[model samples]
Target: MEGVSPEPLRSELDSKSKHDTAKEDDDALKDSTEAEVTKIRLMRAFVESRDPSSKEENDLMMRRFLRARSLDVEKASAMFLKYLKWKRSFVPNGCISPSEIAEDIAQDKVFTQGLDKKGRPIVVTFAAKHFQSKNGADGFKRYVVFVLEKLCSRMPPGQEKFLAIADIKGWAYVNSDLRGYLNSLSILQDCYPERLGKMLIVHAPYMFMKIWKMIYPFIDENTKKKIVFVENKKLKSTLLEEIEESQIPDIYGGQMPLVPIQNS
Candidate 1:
């Protein structure tokens, strides 16, 4: 009994099951490859049908559109085309020079610094420094792009995400501009999909929490999941766990200094 092998029929069944599983895995892989090929063809055809002379045939660009639209070919194509149109109008020169929004850069409100432990960039926003003005909305929008561009420029290969910390120290009703906050959130969450890794709201006052309740409903569930509220007591420890002490600023009980971008 100690040396007994499995019965002949049971051994054969086990062998057959292993072979079946291997074959199933192979078939699944082949099916996935074929589906990807078909999707690429469909994406190209859709773009060509709309713009015969289009030069956007890169697979990465197509994949970005697919991701933006959840891999629906028709929707992705439309979104890509619309993006092209918007890009042309928003950035006619295909670039946003630092000089274009010099005044906005002077605000010293938003700036992205060192990377976290996961290599994701860190964006720090001082709400107390940001004040809404009627004539500054457009410039502020450009500044948003400028901040994104700065962070994106710093992104190393294979890194596609970033973190944010909104410092609400000294923030009051005068600093709370509901319309501006919504617009900025939309630009970051909607226009720039899949970029945010997390957004920590630190030192939020009771009044700020009340404002957040109103604005929270407008945020998508996916974006909402990326947000976290940390009280002043926990701010240092919570941030230190995710980011390096040198990377974080002294204002947040870290060693780093908050240096505003002098030129860009």
Candidate 2:
């Protein structure tokens, strides 16, 4: 027999869902506007002190500017704070049989790296290499691990500050890689998914194991406030370790940090 006319209840439910979605969007816009107003009131004009007399001063200025530039991250920060939040390192602090420790002494290598012709780490060189292989992410991540470790080892002791990089390579990504990363993040309910959205896809010359200084941008407000773009040197080092460790877990997920864990 032919189907009867659809029930009024079904139509009403669909209409209600769309109306609710629209109202929610409208409310979000209003909240965002208010936040912008608050931000304007708290901000002040300043110049970028790219060249300062001392390295200490130079680092501090760079740190401040990066912090100031970071967009509202209240959502991202709140969600990550709850998960066992301890800074991680590539080598476990307590592991009796430690991983291989480099023999080279930490020098004042900051003077040597992280800059361009006028003094910058060949960020573009790092980025260009991203597409050189099939596993672009994995290549980048390993590059961070290698380069940062070398930098840290070379950095002079008692230096309170270190270099912070936002290389063009870090922000740029391949279409296929980007889609895969975003998809994995969306399915993850409580994980630091924003790190995926905000991940500084670095194109370091040859460093990160895959996810270095990269946190999923998907997070809550209070938690996001803690996300510093120029991650504190300790945090940067520690996060690198954690991301690396997570990538090469013993008998765990068969996925590398730079490579998409999805197909695996």
Which pairs clash in the backbone of model 1? none
Query: Which residue segments of model 2 deviate by more than 4 Å?
Result: 1-129, 132-140, 169-264
Report the lDDT tens digits of candidate 2 across residue range 1-264. 257556776898889987775565345334344544344223211121221222222222222222333533343233323221221232234121212212111211111222211121211112322332244443333333344343334333222122232333343344224432333333232322221112222233333324432434553353344324433334335334323433322212313222111111
* TM-scores of the candidates in the order shown: 0.76, 0.24
Candidate 1 yields a Cα-based lDDT of 0.74
Candidate 2 TM-score, true structure as reference: 0.24
Candidate 1: residue 182 lDDT (0-100): 85
lDDT of each: 0.74, 0.31
Tens-digit lDDT track of model 1 for 131-189:
78546677667667767767766775556678989889899988988877887787775
| Model 2 Cα RMSD, 1 decimal | 21.3
